[model samples]
Target: MPADAARTDEEWTSLGRSVLLRQLALGARSRHQLDRKLAEREVPPSVASALLDRFVEVQLIDDAEFARMWVRTRIAAKSLSRSSLRRELAEKGIAVELVEDALEQVSDEDEIEQARDVVRRKLRMSADLADRTVREKEMRRLVGVLARKGYNPGSAYSIVKEVIAGAAADAAEGAEPEG
Candidate 1:
């Protein structure tokens, strides 16, 4: 007979708790993620539900907090736009409302600034921006980079234009003959 064949509900609950605690120790997880982990371990449905409920009751599991921290960290580290962050949270099974609450922490100015910074970094690594053809190609490539990072097309185009123009002006100022 299988080892679990003779286990009682209490035994299954204990196993579930052990698995949950271990997973939590690694990092915060959404309720959905924990549920999937329990399911993968083949813990009985009722026992898994009970254990998860208890964890929630004691605040060991909080999707809201997880979403908030995730948003803050991803934005700071990746310079991701709100759309990209939304897609990431949704993939993690966070509820729409919780995702919105977390996204509220990122203001419009914050998004624009992050986008500008991304464009500036890309512009710095490219070929000369003084050549008309090179500047146009760089503009398209930079805008595409921001687009992939989840900026709106119009906004991405505008930011790329603004950053490239600033870089070109800086380069021109440096090239001017000394008095």
Candidate 2:
């Protein structure tokens, strides 16, 4: 950006492309995100659209690819449920179809396993959950945590029950008269 600027559409187009490329270089961004950035900078709509279209053509901007990557990393790293994943991508301006497709990567079984793992990990971390009252209160909290992460009530309840029961059985076995 200089005090003296060129007065040609070509110059504006180049500038827009530079801004867009800098963003793309940082990481994947939804089309909506990119458009908002260009708009904020007062890039002409036509120039922004043309440059964005060109970027799409060159595969520099692929919403579908971005959605897939987002789903993979988020699920693996955050253990987010399909419902949570869908909502997150939608917030990022990903298309419904793409979000659904990305969510397909997580199977129902996998989601359940993740839910179970979350409950187990949380219970293990809360050593104060020793008595029945404490366990019940902690179980409710655990179920709520899962529910907030998009787990269905039934799934969260069942997983919480299973983890608590399993821990009780382990404690019972371990409490046998020490020799």
Candidate 3:
């Protein structure tokens, strides 16, 4: 065993706290997630607990703020649905109430538009495919992508259809001979 592994529990605890502090400085993390990570790194339960408590006391690990930021980032980057976001927050160890509050800040219209934008961006990359095939494939692909991104099936389907139709129209127009 390494010399460090033979150290007393208190020494290990201090080392764990230092490592966890560095991790938190890099990005936000949920208490549960951090605990799990610390455990995986072989940090003792007592040490991890103390470190987590210190973090919470210092406001470095606020579940409420974490939930809000998580929702905002996911919605803005991936256009995920409230259901998906809720599930994700739960997995990250956030309370149900906090997740609900965070979700309240995201509107249905905003999610729909974000979903549309994702589909549009993906469609642009497949411009070489034939029109009808492209529309069909993109519709299915978009719906799946949005669903995985945490969008509801109904909303994902609706937005995918709209985006596919618009792309189809554009493709047809572009193919026509200029007058």
Candidate 4:
């Protein structure tokens, strides 16, 4: 039979299983994400749904697990705020309730530390510039960066100021004249 011939039911199931395995191998994905990807690959909805059910049954595919892992990875790697994480998870088709549960795992201290780290990194990047200009530019950049990363403006500003002040104090001490 030519390649274009419609696949037998068995062949369709086998193909879908292969595709689902490949997708899972890439990383954890929510059911919606998987469905979209499988559909994009031209898998019939029925076959895709069946394969997804099998994966779920075998514990190979899980939205709750995917949400937890996604939250952890994004927060650690990107220092994303809960808001940013929530938005990203939503965009990935995760349910809001699941996203909230995952976000709840991120403590306030962790978020503040992440925000501080973001400010420190930006401050370091702009270190060679003039102090006033550097502070102003860095404050603006850090605010925007944190905001984009899902932090509130007030928290972002406070963290940026704190980091910049610390950096300036350190620089001043290092520049002091020795006896």
Query: What would the TM-scores of all predictions be?
Result: 0.92, 0.88, 0.76, 0.85
* Residue 33 local lDDT, model 4: 88
> Judged by lDDT, which candidate is best?
1
Candidate scoring better on TM-score of 2 and 3:
2
| Candidate 2 ranges beyond 4 A from true positions | 1-7, 125-130
The residue-level lDDT of candidate 1 at 148 comes to 87
lDDT of 3 at 179: 100
**Candidate 4 structure quality by residue, lDDT tens digits, 27-145:** 88888888898887677788889889988899998888889999889877889998888888899888888889888888999789878987777666437434687668878887999
Give the Cα error of residue 64 in candidate 3, in Å.
Answer: 1.3
TM-score of 2: 0.88
Clashing pairs in 3: 81-150, 81-151
Candidate 1 yields a Cα-based lDDT of 0.91
| Count of backbone collisions within predicted model 2 | 0
Which is superior by TM-score, 1 or 2? 1
lDDT of candidate 2 at residue 106, scale 0 to 100: 85
Model 3: per-residue lDDT, tens digit, 73-98?
Answer: 98776667788899999999998999
lDDT of 1 by residue, 1-179 (tens): 99986899989998999999999999999988999999999999999999989999999999999999999899888888999999999988899999999999999998999999998877754478888999999999888899888999999999899988889888889889999
Model 3 residue 122 distance off true place after TM-score fit, in angstroms: 2.2
Give the per-residue lDDT of model 2 (tens digit) for 1-179: 75324446787788788889899889999887898888887777888899889988999889999999998998788778898889899888999998888888888999999998888877854444458788888889989989988888888999898988888777777778888
